[model samples]
Target chain A: MSSILKITDLHIAVDGKPILKGVNLEVKQGEIHALMGPNGSGKSTLAYALAGHPKYEITGGDIEIDGASLNELDANERARLGMFLAFQYPVTIPGVRVADFLRHAVTNRRDPDRKEGENLMPMREFRQELRGRMNELGMDPEFARRYLNDGFSGGEKKRMEILQMAMLKPKFAILDETDSGLDSDAVKVVSEGLSSLAGPETGVLIITHHERLLEFNRPQFTHVMLAGRIVETGDASLAHELHANGYTTVRERHPAEAAEEQAEREETLATV
Target chain B: MSTVTVNSAPSLPSGFTSDDFEVFLQSRVEPVWVTQRRRVAFELFQAKSAEELDPEEWKRIPARAFRPEKFSLTGKAAIGFDTAQLPLMQNRAEFEGAVVHVDGSATESRLTEQLAAKGVIFGDLATVLCQQADLLEPHFATKAVLPDTDRFAAWHGAFWTGGTVLFVPKGVQVDAPLYSLVALAQDGVADFSHTLVILEDGAEATLLEETASGSPDIAGLHVGAVELLVGKEARLRYVQLQNWNQKSWHFAHQCGRVEGNGSLQWTVGGLGSKLAHIHQDVHLDGRGAEAQVNGVTFAKDRQCLSYYTQQTHNAPDTRSDLLYKDVLTDESRVIWRGMIKVEPEAQKTDGYQRNDSLLLSPTSRCDAIPGLEIEADDVRCTHGATAGRVDVDQIFYAMCRGLTEHEAMHIIVQGFLQTVTDRIPVELVRETLDKAVEVKLGIGE
Candidate 1:
C-alpha cells in the first residue's frame, strides 16, 4: 500500500530551540506506527510540527500527504487535508459546546471528492454516528452538552479527544502524548479506540512513552526520536528492545550508526 | 451591604459642568407634574455640591461629551424596518388595557377613545395630569428614577411633553406589551419621553419600549426615563431597544423598585447612536426579591457607549445579578461600571456582577469597572470585569474551518456577545436583538 504520510529530513524549531532535526519517517495505510523516546526526545515536538502548530517552525523539511506538499497549509488546512491531532492537554473553550464544535469540525473537513451539489450527511445521522463513537470510547452522554473540555477530568478529556479522532476519521492522525497522564485502564481504552478507528484508509502515529500501549495496539513499525532527529527504526520488536535495554545500547554500539539506521528505515519503507 | 461610602473612587471632570445643563433644562418641560418634578429636581441636584462630583462620592460615569441638553431634538420621523413578514406586534392587543401611541415627540389624540371604555387612563403627560389627576398624583415620579438625577433627568422632568402615563389596576395583567415608537423624525429636535409604569401588587405585564431614528444629517437627543414599581409577587419585564441615528446622542435612566418577593428583569440593547449613556438602578426593598439586569452594546465608528448599573440589596436574602458586554469596532469605545451594594443588615444577600468587552479593532477601547460593597459578614458578593481583544487563535481556528478573516471575526464577536443575549427570555425580542447584532456587524443580508 502507498504511504499515507511521508516526511523527509524534517527540521523543526520551537521558541528558538531546534527540536526536530534531520528526521525521516513514513507510515503506510492500515499501519500503526508507535513513536517512542525518553523525555525531551522531541517526540511531542515532532507531532506538533507535523500538525502545523504555530509556535513550531519547520526550517528545512518536506511533509507530504499522499505526495501533496502540506507545508503550504495552515493548521485548519492541514486538518482539512485529512490530518488530526489528539492533544495531550486539550484546551478548554468555555462557551463552545462539544456537539456544536463536532458539527463544525465535520462540516469544515468534508471530503473533497464529494459532488458539488450533493449533501454530505443529515444532522440526525451525523449525531447518531457521533453518539456511537462516544459510546465506544466509554464517554458519558452528558459530555456532549458540556463546554469543550471545560472542567473535564484527565481521563474524560483523553477519551473525548479519542472520540473526536474516531469521528473525524482522518487519513492521518498524530496522537501527541495521549497516554501521558492516563491511568492503566484509560491507556487500554485509548489504544483500543485508535485500533477500532484505524483501517486501510487511515494511518495513525501515536507518540507516547508507555510500551504497554504498544502491547495492546501492536504497532507495525517503531521509531526512536532524540534531540531533534530520528536515531533508530525497526519492526515492533525494536520497541521491546529499547524498552528493556533503553537507548544506551544503540548509543554505545555506534554513535555514528544512528544516521544510517534512520536512512535505511526510510529507504525500506519507500520501496514497499 | 454596609452604608460605608466610597472614599477613593477615581474621578474625571470636564469643563461643561452640570449647572450649564441645568439652566437648559429649566426652559423645556411644560406639563404640571413634569414642572413640579423639575423644580424639586433642581433643589435636590443643586444641593449635590462639588463634593458629590468627586469620584469617591459619586461613582465614575464615562468620560464623554456632556452637552446632552444643548442638542436640539428634532421631532421623530417615521422609521421603516424590513422585518420581512414577521408579525408587527409581538402579542395580541389588550382591548381592556390603557393604550397610548407615541410617534417621536408627538402623541396621537385618539388614544383616549380605546382607553375610555375600560376606565384605563392613557394619555400624554399633560392630558393625564389634567384629566386623571387622582391617578397621576400618587404614581408620577414615585420610583427612585426621580428628577434629581443629573442634568438630563432635570430636563426630562421639567420639559418632557412626549412622556406616557399608564395606570394598570390591581390584579389586571396586560397580555400584550405596551409598545411605542419614539422616532427622531425631524432635524434638530430633542425628543424627551418618560414612561411611568406602576404594576400594583400581584399584577403581571411586559412593557416593550422601542426607540429608533432615521434621518442621517439630523442631530437629535433622546434623554428618556422609565420608573417601574413591581409590587409583591408581581413580575415585570421592560425591554428597551435603542437604534437611534448614528449622529444622535441618547441617554436614559431607569429605576425599578421590587417589593417583597417581586422580580424585575431589565434587558437593554444598544446598537446605534453616536454616544449613549444608560443608568439602571434596582432597589430590592423587601426580602426574597430578585432582579436580573442584562445589557449589550455595539459601538463602531468612534461611537461611545457608557453604562452605569447599580443593584442595591436592602433587605435580607435578596439576590441581584448583572451581566453587560460590549463589542467595539473601529474607533468605538465602551465603559461599563457595575456595582452591587449589600446593606449591613441585609444578611444572606447574594449579589454578583460581571462586565466583559471584546475589542474588534486596534483603535477600539473598552473599560470595565466592577465593584462590591459588602457590610454583612454572612453575604456572598462577587464582581469581576475583563477587557480582551478578539483571540487571534480562535479566529484562525474558525478561518481554517473555511471562514475568511472577516467571517471568522464576525463569528467570534457574535459568540462574545451571545453570552449576554442568551439571558433574554422573550423569543421575538431575542430574534430582534440577533437581527440588530447582524446589522451592526455588517453580517447577513
Candidate 2:
C-alpha cells in the first residue's frame, strides 16, 4: 500500500537557523505515526512544515500527498485538501463563540450542493449538531457557547482542539504534543478521541514526548527525530528505547552519523 | 422664460435667526415653563462658539474640513416611512417593547393612539408641549446635557424644529422599541432636532435614534441633541445608529442621567458621514446608578474624525464604563479622546474607559487620548488604548486554514469589531452592521 504522505529531503529553517535540515518520512493511511524527540529536535517544526506553516521556509523539500506536490499550496488550501493541525497550544480567541467558529469551518468544508441555498447552518440545527459532537467527546454543552478557548483550562483547550479535528474530519491530522500539560485522565480521553478518528483514509501524525501516550494509542510507525533530521525509524517499540536510553546515548552511539547524512543529502539535492 | 439651473441654492426661510425660536416658543398653548427654558437655552446657545480648530486635539476630525453652509435639506418625502409607528422590520419584534419613528422636521409619527392607552406617549415635542406640556417641561434638556457647550448645541437648542418626547409612566414596561430618525435632505440645508426620553420609576424601555440623509452625495448638516432621564429603579437602553451620507456633516450631543438604582445603556454605531462629532456624556447622579457606553466607527479614504466622551461618576457607589473602537483605512484618520471623572464626594466609584483602533493600511492614522480624573480617594478608575494592525500570527493561522490573506484579515477585523455588533438589540441591524463592516473592509461582493 502506498503512503498517504511522502516527504523526501525536506529541509526547513526559520530565521536562517537550521530546524529541519534534511528529513525523510512516510505516513500511510489509517496509521498513527509517532515522531518523538527531545526539545529542539524539530518534532513540532516537522509537523508545522508538513502543514505548510509560512515560517517553515521549505529550503529543499519534495512533500507529496499521494504523488501530488504540496509545497506550493497555502495553509488553507492544504486544509481544503484534507490537512488539519491542532496547535501545541491552541490560541485563545475572545468574543468569538466556539459554535460560530465551528459552523464557519464546517460550512467551508461542506460540498457545494450541501451548502446550496443554505450556507449558514441554522442556529437550531447547528446547536443540536454541536451538542451531539460535544457529547461524543465527553464535553460540556456550555463549552460551545463560550469564546473559542477563552479562559479554558489547558486540558479543556486540548479537548476542544480534538473536537475541531473530529468536526472537520480532515484526511490528514497533525496533533502537536497534545499530551503536554494534560493530566493522565485527560491524556487518556484525548488518546481515545484520536483512536476513534483513525480510519483507512485518514493518516495522523502525533508529535509527543511521552511513551505512555503511544502505549494508549499504539502507532503503526515510530520515528526518532534529532537535530532537525530523522536519525532512526522503527516500530512502536522505538518510543520505549528512546524513553529508556535517552537521546544522549543515541547521539553518542552515532555522533558523526547525522553530519554524514546531511552532506550526502546536500550532494544529492545539488545534483537534482 | 429663461431656462433655470437645477443647481441653484435651496430656498431658505425669510430670515434665519435666533428670534424665530422665541416667536415659535411664544405660540405654545401651555404654561411658560418650557418656553422660558427654550429662551434661556437659546441665549446660552447664541453665546457659545464653534469648536476651534485645535490641531493638537481635533486636527484629524473630518468635521474640521466640512463647509457648514453647503448642507441642504432632505427633499420632499424621501422615504415614505410612517414616522409614528415602529420602524423595526419583522425580525426585531421579539426583544423590543415599543418603537417610534420621526423625521428631522416634524414628528409625523403619532404612537400615542396605540401606546397612550397603555400610558405611553410617543409624539412630536411640539405636540407634547401643547398636550403633555406639564410632563414634558421637567425634562426638556434638564438632564446631563447642557446647551452652552458648543455651536451645534446652541444651534440645535435655538432653532430646533422637530423632536420626540417619550414619557413612559411609572411601573410600565414597554415591550416594543422607540425609534427617532433625523433625515437630512437637500444640499446646503441644516436640520436641528432633539429627543427627550423620561423613563419613570421602575419603568423599562429601549429608545433607538437613526440619522441618515436622502442621498449619498447631497451635502447636508445635522445638529441634533438627545437627553435621556432614567428615574429611580428604571432601566433604559438607548441606541444611536448614524449613517449620514458622505457629503453630510453631523454634530450631535447625547446625555443620560441615571437616578438612584437606575441603569442606562448607550450604544453608538457611526458608519457614514464626511465629518462627524458626537459628545456623549453620562452622569451617574444617584447612588448605585450605573451607565454603559459603547461606540464603534469605521473611517475609510480621506475621512477625518475625532470622538470625545466623558463618563462621570457624581454620586457615591455610582459606576460608568465607556468603550470606543474604530477601524481606519486608506488616508482616513481617527482620534478617540475619552475621560473618566469621579467627583470628590463620590466614594467607592468605579469607572473604566477603553479606546482601541485597528489600522488597516500604513497611511491610516489613529490617536487615542485616554484620561482619568479622580477626586475621590476610594475610587477605582482605569483607562487603556491600543492601536494596531492585524495580528500577523492570527492572519497566518487563518491563511494556513485555507483562507487567502484578504479573507484571513477580514475575519480578524470582523472579530475585532464583533463587540460592537453583538450589542445591537435588533438582528437586522447587526447583520447590516456586519455587511457595512465587510464593505468597509473592501471584501464584500
Candidate 3:
C-alpha cells in the first residue's frame, strides 16, 4: 500500500498568534499538490508545521504518516519518517561541505535508528552517487567540495535545495517557495529538476507563486489558502485560472475568509 | 593522598625551592656553559617568583587552587609506559623522524637514515644538546623564548628536560613530516619538556608534536617552551597538539622567528588540560619574512584555556597572519588576547590577526580581546575578535536533514573551526585535529 500523509484540522500559531487555523489536507505517495496563497496566508506556516519546526506551535493538529502521529516528533524525527522541507531561505552552514552534509543526511535517512558517530555510507559509494546526482542536476561537481550555501547566489541556493531533495528522496517533499526570487531560466531549471525528482514513490507539495513551476510539474490537486485556512480546493484548471487571473476572483467567491485576511493585514500593518 | 602542611611550619617552600633546583642540577650531566645558563635562569626564577605575576595577564586566569608543592619532578621515566596510546598524529602518516619523551625522559628517538644523511638532526633535546652543542648553542636560548621574559619561562629554562629537537641544514628540504610525543604517566610528575626547531638558510621541514597524560586520572604538570628559528629563505611548518588529561596544569611560552625571505606556519590545537595558559609569539625579523599562525582550542567542563598571542613585524615587507578558533561548552571558559605590533623600520608590512569563538552552552563563556600597535606609517595592520553562540537556525536546518541535536552541534562546532583548519596545509594534521574534535565532542571512534 502507498504511504499516506494525513493532516486533520491542523492549527498552528507563531509566537502565540494563530497563522494556520484549522487546515485539513491529505496527500499520498506519488501525488503532486500545489499550495497557492497570498502573502500572510499561512502557506509557509503549514510547511514549517509539517516539518515540525519548534517555533511553529501546533495549537490543535494531528499530522501523521501511515498511522503514526508526528505532532510530538522534532524536525529530525520527522525527517527520518521521510518528510523533507526545502526551505525558501536556505541557511548557510559555514565550513560544512555540501557533500559531507548530504552524506550525513542520506545515511540517517537510510538508517533511522543509527546513532551519532556511527558508520556513514562508504565514501567511494557516496561519492559516486553524489557525483551522479550532481551531474543529473547540472551542478558543478566542484560544488560538492564548497561550503554549504556559503557565498552562493540566489539561483545557486535554490538549486541546492532541489539538490538536497533529490539526494534525500523523501516520501513527501515540500518545496516552500523554492523557485521564488529566481529568473525564468532558473525557474525552469528548478521546475524541471522537481519534475524529474518527484517519481512514482515520491510525493511532492510545491509551495510557490510562480506559474513556471506549476507549468512544468502540473499538480493533480491545487489547494488555495486564505486567512490561515484552506478556503478552496480545486484542480489544475483552477490553478491556471488563478495564475492567469489572481486571488481576486477566489476572494470574491469567499468573502468571509477574504474579510479575515483583510483584518490580518490591517493588524500587521498597524503593528509595523 | 598528600597532606598539606601549614605555612607556620618551616616546610620547604611549596614548589621549586632552591633545594629542589640544586638537586635537579646535580642529576643532569651537561657542559659548563649550559650549567652557567641554568644557574642564571635559576636566579631569575627566584627573583621573578618573589614578585607578583603580571596582573594584566593573570587577572582573568584563576590560579588560587594551583599548588605547585603538590607536583614534583620525577627523577626517572616510568617503565613500559606506552606513548603510542596517547594518539594525536602517531601512525596517522609517514614521518621522516620521531621522538617520544615520558616523564621528562627520552624513551625513543629516531631519524630516518636518508634524512640524517642530509644533515637533518632529529632527537630528544637532551641527547641533541649534548651531541650537537656547538651547532645548537647559538640558537637554543639566545633567540626566541628568552628566560627572563617571565617566571614560567625562567623556571622552564632552568629545569628544562627531555623534548624533541629538529634541525635542518641550509637548503635541504625534508619533505615528509616528523612526529614527537611528550607524555606523563605518574601522579605528581612534572614534565618540563621543550621543543626546539631550527631551519637554516633555504631549508624546509615540518614537525608535529603532541603532549598527553598516560591516563585521565593522573595529576601532572607541564612547564614547557617551544622555539622555532627559520633562517633566511627557509620554510618550516610546526604543529603542537596539547592533549593532556583534565588533571594536568600546562604553562608554555612558544615563539617563532622568521628571517629574511623565510616563512613559518604554526598550528596549535588545545584540547585537554585542567587549566592552560600559552604565551605564543611570532616575529617577522627580516625583509620579506612571513608567518601564518593557526589555533584550534576546545574547552569543556570546568576547564579554563587561555592564549596570549603576539605577532611582531620588525623588518620591511614582512607579513604575518594569525587566526584562532575556540569552542567552549559546559561551564568552561576561553580567553584570547591578541596583539599585532609593527616596528618603525618595518615599513610596507602586512599584519592580520583574528579570533573567532563558539560558545555551545549558556553557561560557557569566552573573552576575546584584539589590539594593534603600529610604529610604521606605511604598514597595513588589522585585527578582530568575535564571540557568539551556535545559531539555532543552523541547528534546525541540520536537524531537518536528519542529524540528531548532538550531531548537529558537533558538525556546527567543527564548521566554526574550519576557517582556521583551512589555513593548515597538512592533511594528516587536519584529519588528526578533526578526529580530536570528535573525541572531545564525545562522539566518533
Candidate 4:
C-alpha cells in the first residue's frame, strides 16, 4: 500500500473567506512533518481541512490518501480512512466517562472494514488495554472514572489527547498545538510519549507556533505557513534557524505574500 | 391539521357509573367516617369532569387523551395477584420490614422482631384501618393531602383498597430500612393505593416504595396517593420507584409536610408507564425545617411522562432543594413544571430547583418550565431548566474508539442519568434503579 497523503493546489475557505489558498504538500508514512506559522497563518486550517471539518470548505484542490479522495467525507469517515486530527480544544461531554468512550472508539477503529456490531473488544481486554496505555502516559488510574474532559486542567487535556493517539494508533496523525497549554516539563513528557507511540508505519504532522516541541520529537521536514500559504520548506535545520534568527528572514524572503496578507487584513478591517 | 378529532369533554370510563360506585362501596367494609369521606369524594368526582379545568401546563401529559371507557373496573379480584412470585421483591432479606401488595391486596407482610418490639407498624392499609384506626384516621387523606384536591385524589378516596401504613413512633430510629412493593398484575384493573407514612417527634427511618407490574402491555390504571408527615425534629428518607408496564396509565398525588427542625429527603425514579401524570409537592411548614427532593425519569418508546413539583417554604429559616433529571428516547415526551415559592413570613429561606432533560432521539421532545414566586424579602431562591440533545461529538468520540452507535448511546445515557441516581443514598435502592436503567436501555444482554 502507498501510505502517502498528497495535497495539491488546495484552496480552502472559512465562511466563504479564503484561508488556505493554493496550498500544496505531500506526507508519507514513517516520516514526521512539522508545520509552524504565525497566528492565523492557516496551519491549523490544513489540519482541520484534512480531518474533514465541515466549517473548513475546500473550494479548490484535492486531498488524496493513497489516490482516494477525502474532500466529500465526514470527520468520522476521514478517521476511518487512516486520518486523525487531535483537536486544539477538546470538547467536554459531562456524562460520558473517559474509559468507556475510548473503548467504543478503539472497538470501531481497529477493524476499519469490520461491519457494524462485529469485532468489538470484550470488556476485560478493553479495560486492560486502556489501563496499560493510561499508565504509559502517567495518567491516574482514577482518570478513567472521570467524565471526559469535564473540569480537566489544560495540561491534562493535552495529555488526554496524546493518550487517545497512543490507543487509536492511526496511520496519519495530526497533533494541533498539542503542547500549547503545557509547561516545559509537561511538553517534554508529551513529546516523549508521542515518540514512543508512533512507529515505521505511522505518519505525524505536528502543527505549532513554537520550536520547543520540535526539540524532543524531531521532524524530518519543517514547513512555515504565512497567510494561508506555505512559503518556505527545509530540513530540521530550518526550524533551528527560525528559533535562532526568528521568522524575520521568512517575512523578508516572502515580501509579496506578506504584502498581500497586509492588504487582505486592511480590507477585512474596512468591511468590519 | 383539521383532520384531528376534537372533544370538549372527556367521558367517564365505561361500566364505571354511579351504580357501579354504589356496588363497589357496598362490597367493602369500613368505618363511618371513611364511608362519609368516600361519599363526599364520589359526589365531587361525579359533579366534575377532567376537562373543566386543567393545570394549563399539564396539556403536555397524555392523561386526558385516554378514554376511561376503554378500561374495565371489574378486573380479576385484587387477590388474583401473587406477590410471592415477584422476582423483584424476592431477595430482600436486608430490609427491616417487607410488605408486598398485588393489585391492591397484601400478599406478604413481614417485619423484623426488633422493629416489632419497638412498636414499628408496617402493614397493609386495610389491616391498619382495623388494627390502628385511631392513629391512621388522623393522618390519612386529611392534612398532608386532602381528598377534595383533584379527580385522582377523589377517585383514590372513593376506592383505596390496598396500600401501606408505616408508623415510626416518637424517638424510635429503625436501624434497617423498610421496603414495600406495589405490583399490578391483573389486566384492566384500577389500583387505588395509598402510602401514609407518619413519623412522630424525633423519629428517624428510611422507606422505599416500588411501583411495578409483573406483566408487560397489560392494560392497567393506578390512581395512588402518598402523604408523608415528618413531625418535629424527625428525619425521614423516602424513595419511590415507579416502574409500571408499558400498557399502564398512572396518576398520583404525593405530598410531604415537615414540622419544626424536621428533615426530609425524597428520591423518586420514574422509568415506566405508557402515560403518567404526577403532582409532587413538599411544604416546609415549620421553622428550621429542611427538605431535599431528587428524582430521575427514564422514558422510552412513545411514553409520555409529566411531573409537576412544588417546594413551598411556608416558615422562617427553612430550606428546600430539588433536582430532577429525565432521559427520553424514541418518540417519548416529557414535561416538567416546577416552582419554588417563599411566603412572606418565610424570611431567611433558601430554595433551589433544577430540571434537566436529555433527549436521546431527534423525535423525542421535552418541555421544562421552572418558576419562582417569592413574597419574602430576605431569601435566596433560584430555579433552572435545560432541554438538550445528547452531544453529537460525545457520540462521535466514543465511536472513534470502536463502539457502534448503539453501544455509545447506552454509555452516554447511563452517564447522563447518574446525576440523579447517585443521590439515592441507599445502596440497594440505587442498585434497583441501576437495573431499571439497564432494562430500559436493553443493555444487559
Q: Worst lDDT window (10 residues) for model 3 chain A?
A: A235-244
TM-score of 2: 0.83
Where does the lowest 10-residue lDDT sum fall in candidate 2 chain B? B1-10
TM-score of chain B of 1: 0.81
Give the per-residue lDDT digits (tens) of candidate 1, residues B1-445.
1111223112211211355445555545445655566667655543432223345423443433444334543334344432222222323232233223333444343333443454444456556666777767777776667776664575466445566666666666655556544566555567777877777777777766666654567677777888888888888887877877787877788888898898898888887788877788999989998899888888898788888889999999999988888889899888787888888878999998998888888999987888888888899988888888887666654533333456556556656776787898876677777677767777654
Question: Chain A only: TM-score of every candidate?
Answer: 0.87, 0.87, 0.98, 0.95
Give the CAPRI class of candidate 4: acceptable
Candidate 1 per-residue lDDT, tens place, A1-272, comes to 55568999998888876767778999876778989876666888887787777888888889997889888677777877778788877765556677766766676677533322235467898889888988887788888878767789887888888887777778888888888888898888887877777667778888877787787778888888765677778888988898888878866655664554465557758999
Tens-digit lDDT track of model 4 for B1-445: 1010122245455555678788877877777777888888877666544435354744566654576555554423465555655545346456878887777777778888889899889988877787787778888899877778866677678777788888999999976788899888777777888998999999998888888887786788888999999999999999998889888888889999999999999998888889888899999999999999998999999999889999999999999989999989899998888999999999999999999998988999888889899999999998888888887776655544445456667777777777777777888877777777777877653
Write out fnat for all predictions, comma-separated.
Answer: 0.12, 0.42, 0.85, 0.40
Between candidates 1 and 2, the TM-score winner: 2
DockQ of each: 0.17, 0.31, 0.77, 0.30
What is candidate 2's lDDT per residue for B66-102, written digit by digit as tens? 4544443332344564433422222343322333323
RMSD (Å) per prediction:
7.4, 6.3, 2.9, 5.1
Candidate 1 chain B has its poorest 10 consecutive residues by lDDT at: B1-10
Q: Name the top DockQ candidate.
A: 3
Candidate 3: stretches off by over 4 Å: A248-272, B1-13
The candidate that wins on lDDT is: 3
